[model samples]
Target: MRVLCATALALAAVVVPALTAQAEQPVNLGSTQIVDTVGALGGQEAEVESALNRLYNATGAQLFVVYVATFDGVAADESWATATAEQNGLGTDDVLLAVATEERIYDIFYPSDFQLDTEATREVENEFLPLLSDENWAGAALAAADGYREAIEGPGFPWGFVLGVLVVGAVVIGIVLVIGRRRASARHTAELADLTKLEQRASRALVHLDDSLTTSEQELGFAVAQFGTEASAPFVEALEAARTKVGEAFRIKQTLDDGVPETDEQARAGLLRILELCDQADDELDRQADAFDELRALEQAAPQTLVQVRADAERAAARLSAAIEALRLLEQRYSSAAVATVEDNTEQAEMLLTFVGRTASQAEGAIAAGKSGSAAIQLRTVQASVAQAGQLLDAIDSLGDRLAEATQSLDAVVADTRHDLAAAKAFQAEATSAELSAGIAAAEASLAVAESPSTLANPVARLERLTAANQELEGTFGRTRDAHTRIQNARVALDGTLATARGQIVAAGDFITTRRGGVGETARTRLAEANRRLDQAVSLAGDDPVAALAEAQQANSLAGAAISAAQSDLTSYQPVGPSRGMFTGPGVSEAVVGGIIGALIGGRGGGFGGGFGGGRSRSGCFGALGGFGGSSRSSGGSLGRSIGRSVGRSAGRSSRGRF
Candidate 1:
């Protein structure tokens, strides 16, 4: 604008004198009227007359064929024909001048209100409109004016020039606005291009993500399929399944940018959260994989325990497993005892009958040898023989009864013991010899009892005086053993039932906490209480047979209550299948193997059986009966020590193989 104004001022100064010189010149238009569109009113008539004479004096606008018309009939360039227009410095588009002669010509330009358009406007030296630069105008194309042959010129004025210049000013402003708009449009175009590129990239990433997710899902499915199949103890397969899931999840997460940029940070944060979840899953999978690796490594094993390594972790299942093994050993021991008793009874009955027969022969020989004088003595000896025979019969009968009772008890024990050991095996399948000894002691009392003649005797009557005494005694013992087994079974059953219930309570609490924050406190408290109950149950559930049964029932009831409460709290308690898997305590197997060894070396009475002496009456004190005298027929098998040795040796071999 400043440049335009300077140009306008320079042009105005040069044109002012030319116009003054041409002011008196009258254009020969052949009689036509012309009204100025922009000037000082009709003063244009006089002003043009004066300026034309002055301008024509100095320039060569020979003949002008000016056409006259109402101001409305004039074109925008008519502004230049006005008197004040030249003084205001007209622009190229705001003014027009035409010379009506053999050399016809025209010119046009604009003049701005700000007086700034003058610089850029092209100008001509001629006092007339130059011949049209378009090259198409002809002298003959001009129409003759009205019939008077008189020279005519229009009025020049400044009345509407301001508004005309204002219009021109608006045009320049419009140009500026248009330029600014185009700049904004270019910016918008560039932004759109960038956005398109980002969208395409995001789309590609999404496609890859979809593919990764699909692959991960398939891997996870395959892993899950591997679970609960033919996998043996330690279930290495489960670990494998989890490992696959974690590994895939990790890869899926790694594809995302770990160093999130600040741009789109919320979305980046969401991606990061997903990555964390993937990491957690991956970690869990790795753990499971490690577990399986350990388990698979254990498939190979050896058969016996070396002295120094007998109690080592690898030498046995380690703790609870050892206890379970011990209980199993106890069953084996008692069963073996029953078999031994049966064998002993068979042998004892034969020996007693043989003694009885020998005594009769002795009695007959004595009678014959004595003659009349020794007859009475012989008869007394014969009576003594009969009494001895009855006593032998009674002893045989008692032995038979004890054997039957012991056999029956052993059967029941073997069955229950098998089941308990299996349960413990699922939880923890290893322990040491010492642990086995403890489990065995818990399994049966009589198996550990030292033999005593007083406890063994039923001395009220002679055997010959009783009918089916052996059968009767056997039945009695069997009944007693059955009763004791029933009680034990009840207790074990109760413990299992309650443990299951307590597990349900813990699950319910976790569910509630996850689902509903409002009920979290209450649910957590309930879960804590339930956990305490379960812990207590673990301590005493198997202690008292009857109490264990009650505890089991209570545990079951609590489980239901916990589940119901969880559902009420969060509406999310759902039954899970095989939901609870028993945890194998880290050292349970080692303890079991240890207990077994303890039981073997220091049996219940603290001594090995069948020492060196002939059979003697059983004693009650630990290590007393086992000192020199051999054990009686009522001995139990020491299965714990044997099995412990086997499992322990296997475990040891497994460990050494790694070395």
Candidate 2:
């Protein structure tokens, strides 16, 4: 009795737990039109039923969407859905979609009549999973039902239905191709137009600057002449110098206007040069204008203030010395040309300082001798010297800034060149030329030299050399990249062109079927010819890309002509000129042949370069050239005279650029 009691307890322990665990598992809602054992559908059950019913009526395909809290966490949702579908006696045309909301898992099962592959399943999941994740039970069910309808109603494979399927397929592919190509072409055209507009904008700026400078010179000449004293001589000299620089700018502008840029390189170089020259001249003219304003103030000063004038001259001379020293230091770190400018400018400034000191001494002697007339003349001379020294100081103080700006510009170019070089090198790893690598190396060395502290004493030379080397590197890298991209795009174009041509031919076949009652014998003959041409294109696609493109073009042309004829037969269309398709000909035309030959001979293949060339102008020259503007000027020298001088309004801020 004791042994039997122990055995009964052991059996009870196992059986009770199994029964309890089964009860804990999610309740299996009997297979119905829409099962929601988890109450996921809630208020949307009617909507789900309506959608499934409509889909079934339209496509003879049914979908069952079921949601449960969990499939016991062990059995997959797919297995459950299969069992539910089978239990419900769902036919081969039915599709089952099951979700275990709590477990965050879902699965879809396609019946025999609904063929599916990995791609189709992936698409279905992509569409339905998001809705499920959002707890959109009704939406998920409707989406599943819609997907099933599309799959069933979509073109199917069968010998008897081949014509209808092919015709529909061709029409759909044609629409996609035409829309895609048109969009791509529009984008490409916009890009090209933008580049053209950049060039135009630069040209317009040059012209405006030229006109403004002309007006500024006239105003400056008038002011200098009105001052009419030795103090005004420096202002006059500056005005002449500015005029000369402006003249040179005009010559460059004229050169740009004389012809359109033959190549991208030529265009970019010319446009950038125009901008640089115009900016330089603008700066020079601005300095001249400031000097004139100062001179006008000095002219109105009283003769009794000779002492203060001498003191002002002395202070300006000291500032001039400090500025020259700064330039001498700047020379060490920048390019040679930049340092040379500093050296030349500093030398002139020193000569002016010596003049200022001599004039100051003469004015002091005159004041001691009590000759006010002589003192007035000497002080006026001092004021002119001071003004000249100040101009020189302005240039010196800005030298370091200009050098930095130029260096930054070159660095940007170097960065872009290297990026392109890396791409080209990657594409042409074994084919990379020694010259390209050498250019890159030299550019790096130049940049290093420019950046080194040792070069600070002659910074201008290093900066100039670095700029030149980087520019050269840019040219080399650009050509290499263009070649690589051209080849790649050309190869891609072969496939794209063939596909587009085949699509057009298929569309023509579709058109014939849609208008079978209206299509005449001529339309049929042309379509037959188009089919033969398309077959030839396919046969040649592997061996000769160029020939294949030509054949494809011919096929596309013939198909279009046939479609046009069919349409004319359906309606009373007035006869236009001879029907000429995009590429009308029995054989490859001279232009097509020539284009292929040129692509082969040019050694750059074809297409709009690559990622580098696609929209380089938008980021290259203009973005790098921005951020440089005129420096603010100090208040006009504190001349003792309270003369009211009207400083001419600046002719608009120099250049307008967008980042």
Model 2 agreement with the true structure over 332-391: per-residue lDDT tens digits: 555565566556776777788788778777767866776544555567677777787778
TM-score of each: 0.16, 0.33
Worst 10 residues of 1 by lDDT: 650-659
Residue-level lDDT for 619 in candidate 1:
30
Please report, in order, the local distance difference test score of every candidate based on alpha carbons.
0.37, 0.58
Task: Identify the leading candidate in terms of lDDT.
Answer: 2
The C-alpha local distance difference test score for the whole of candidate 1 amounts to: 0.37
Give one digit per residue, the lDDT tens place, for model 1 in 53-143: 3333322222122322222334654432343224332222122233222223232322233112333222222211232233222321121
**Cα TM-score of candidate 2:** 0.33
